[model samples]
Target: MVTVAPTYHVPVLLRQSVDGLNIQPNGTYVDVTFGGGGHSREILSRLGENGQLYSFDQDGDAERNMPPGDGRFTFVRSNFRYLTNWMRYYGVTAIDGLMADLGVSSHHFDDEARGFSFRFEAPLDMRMNSRAGMTAADVVNRYDEERLARIFYLYGEMKNSRRLAAAIVKGRADRPLTTVAHLTELVQPLIGRDRQKKDLAKVFQALRIEVNHEMDALEEMLQAAVRALRPGGRLVVLTYHSLEDRMVKNFMRSGNAEGKTQQDFFGNRLVPLKPVNNKVIIPDEEEQTANPRSRSAKLRIAQKLG
Candidate 1:
């Protein structure tokens, strides 16, 4: 039997995100994506005896990282999409702050069999929760050509999505694409030599996103974050992609449809939340050098307005 190494997820934007939460000493908080429990540990440190921290992680392996039992801390093994519902189950009506660090964890990518990283020659299985849904192999082999193209174009943002999809379709005619190495070779010729690596990463990213329904889950969780926070509560989100960052930015700025600042005929202020920073915060050069994954991270924060 091939023994799988224990999964180790490295939390991104650790200090900046926890600091942005502006945690109140005795206030309640939630870490929507408690991958390696790094941010959760930080939040727990800031909380007082009366404060409580509820964390969520879909991957069961994350439970292994949980801190020793503390009356003030609770960890739920579930996706953050059901954040609001799960919080209610825990008897939490509202919280003082919330944090979501979206996207796959380093542990997920590192597990070769999980197939989240292009570096490993593993089976095309990218489900964050292994038991729940379809795998990358299923999508690559079964999804129709048009649907495949759309997935690449929308999620991966690949310029040659159509051609790539066609290539995949043709390549799989003899047999289904079953592994990262196989798919990589099949699609390599479709992308120019100079841009092959980047294009492949994007394609894999799109597949992972779709396999996990990440964008939809983020949208749901964002709405839940807004609704579950009490007045004066904080929403701190760290996004690695433009789509997630844009959603956070827009939701923080306008706080309503039409992206218009809420106002009456006289133009009086009435926004639901106020942006803590007009621009997104990024990792400094030193930090990026230490952790390359921090290079693409963007942090945005807002405070719920009364």
Candidate 2:
């Protein structure tokens, strides 16, 4: 068992997700979200001398988790959206497996300075790549009310999205929504006490999604993964939210983002990848109780067709 930093919690269903790869010792693989290098390390353990692993993460913090001078490993310090580009740059024509553990990483939420959680009075700067892109404060303070509403509704799945957006717009008119405390104080009034914490988490989730362009980036990475994977290659992904899970499920089923499968004249379903599991895998109660954040995880696996 590999150990991680105190702040970076171990991923749930770690062995199961890695086992889904059906790893080939000499085959090349990629771990697109190497949050704490847990999955990357596991992949390395299963590989032979010639096996290669390219782990991608935008956060500089993740780089700290890289294995100790492994020749087989390469850390790509960029968003997984450029999966194909990075592969091409490395002169790699195809990959045997690609695994992605999607959603805001646990470490991000645990790090108060990152502004992923509302538990602390931190600045709303939820950039995975802290060096780039818009901050959550930027989204809340500058985005139009309608756009804000859509982000909350789509990303956060909040029903009171419109009202929440309106409140932010109105509140920011008086004082900019700059910190977790600032946003929480302004919106806490609108939510009922029973669902306040849950809704507030959603509110932060929406802001984080918009600030990071997560959905768009995920779609791009999936499309690239499809093209990069070789025949019989495994695409094991652990998605945290319904929207991303749906997107992964659809792409694997139909070979497109629309989930529309194409068939030949023989009526054979023409798809690039086949779902390895008919049912999505989730953490059992025992595991969930141990790590509450793993409760929402949905693990989906697919294999590229010949």
**What digit string (tens of lDDT, one per residue) describes model 1 on residues 63-110?**
888888688989998889999889879889999999988877877877
lDDT of 2 by residue, 160-213 (tens): 999999999999999898898989988999899999889998898888888888
Clashing pairs in 1: none
| TM-score computed on alpha carbons, candidate 2 | 0.97
Off by over 4 Å in 2: 1-7
Against the true structure, whose TM-score is highest? Answer: 2
Report the C-alpha displacement of residue 86, candidate 2, in angstroms.
0.3
What does the lDDT read for residue 209 in candidate 2? 83
lDDT of 2: 0.91
Q: Least accurate stretch of 10 residues (summed lDDT) in model 2?
A: 1-10
Task: Give model 2 RMSD, 1 decimal.
Answer: 1.3
lDDT of each: 0.86, 0.91
Lowest summed lDDT across 10 adjacent residues in model 1 is found at 1-10
